[model samples]
Target: MAWWMSSSRSEKGRFLFFVLPSLICWHIWKARNKAYYEGVQMRLGRICHDILIDMKGVVEVQFNQRLGVQTFLQLYEGTAHPPPCYSVQLVGWRVTEEGTLTLNTDGCSKGNPGVSGGGGILRDSLGLPLFVFSTYFGETSSLRAEVLALATRLRLCM
Candidate 1:
């Protein structure tokens, strides 16, 4: 049987292992294209540096470690940002008759067509989270992910 067919590894681990080669190849291909098209030739040393920086950022975020929010912001701002937008935003708000207010905040991957994740939080009158969650969907087109997220959220709300 194929290694992937075995249940020895968790789904997440399997997914990571399965996609690792493709991800590496994708980066190499992209770097080559950048060198050829953008005239931004990067030596292997520079490429390794860039990859290290990227991996650090990913580890910080994944582990929910505050290595410093500013570091993340600087690394992700504008043109320096990676595949996903890192902006925080408000989604909805409501005022209750009991003199209370609520806010719904969400962060979405606008690049659904690309590999992305989506997350949201619903806060009560005190800004305390009633619920919060995030999901990652692998390689897809942005438009397709957008529509799918919308449809999924609508279903969740309903």
Candidate 2:
């Protein structure tokens, strides 16, 4: 079985293992095309740096996740192990000023085009919850769930 198919792989690792290569390759391909078609040239090191930065953005937007034990970034940085995990203190949502409401929403899926759900909380100025909801969409992508969650909240608020 492929490493990605193994049951032993952490979800974060599996995700990155599959996605990072594809994304990096795609980025390289696009850059190659840009160089050939548009007469743009970037140093090899610069191209690598851009691919790495883009990879970080891809990981960040996915729930701010990180690989548990190992990561490509470790190899890129020439480190055998990633830095130790740090304790974080999370604070609840707050409105910038009084009389305002904040909507915090997120969506996730077991797999792309697999079981998905959207969730959110409506909070008052002081972070008091006014309403909260989460609903599963039988078979869908996380992106669809994100849009659905915002749509649902819009209808509910009006």
Best by TM-score: 2
Candidate number of the best lDDT: 2
TM-score of each: 0.31, 0.44
TM-score of candidate 2 against the unseen true structure? 0.44
User: What's model 2's overall lDDT?
Assistant: 0.70
lDDT of 1 by residue, 1-158 (tens): 23334455543335434554564576677789999999988577665555546544554565465444233234333212123437988855454555453433233454544676555565556566666656665677665555556655556555
Candidates' lDDT values, in order? 0.53, 0.70
**Model 1: lowest-lDDT 10 consecutive positions:** 74-83
- lDDT per residue for candidate 2 within 65-122, as digits (tens), equals 5533243455233322234578999985545698889888888778988898888888
Q: Where does candidate 2 clash, by residue pair? A: none
- Candidate 2 lDDT at 34 equals 89
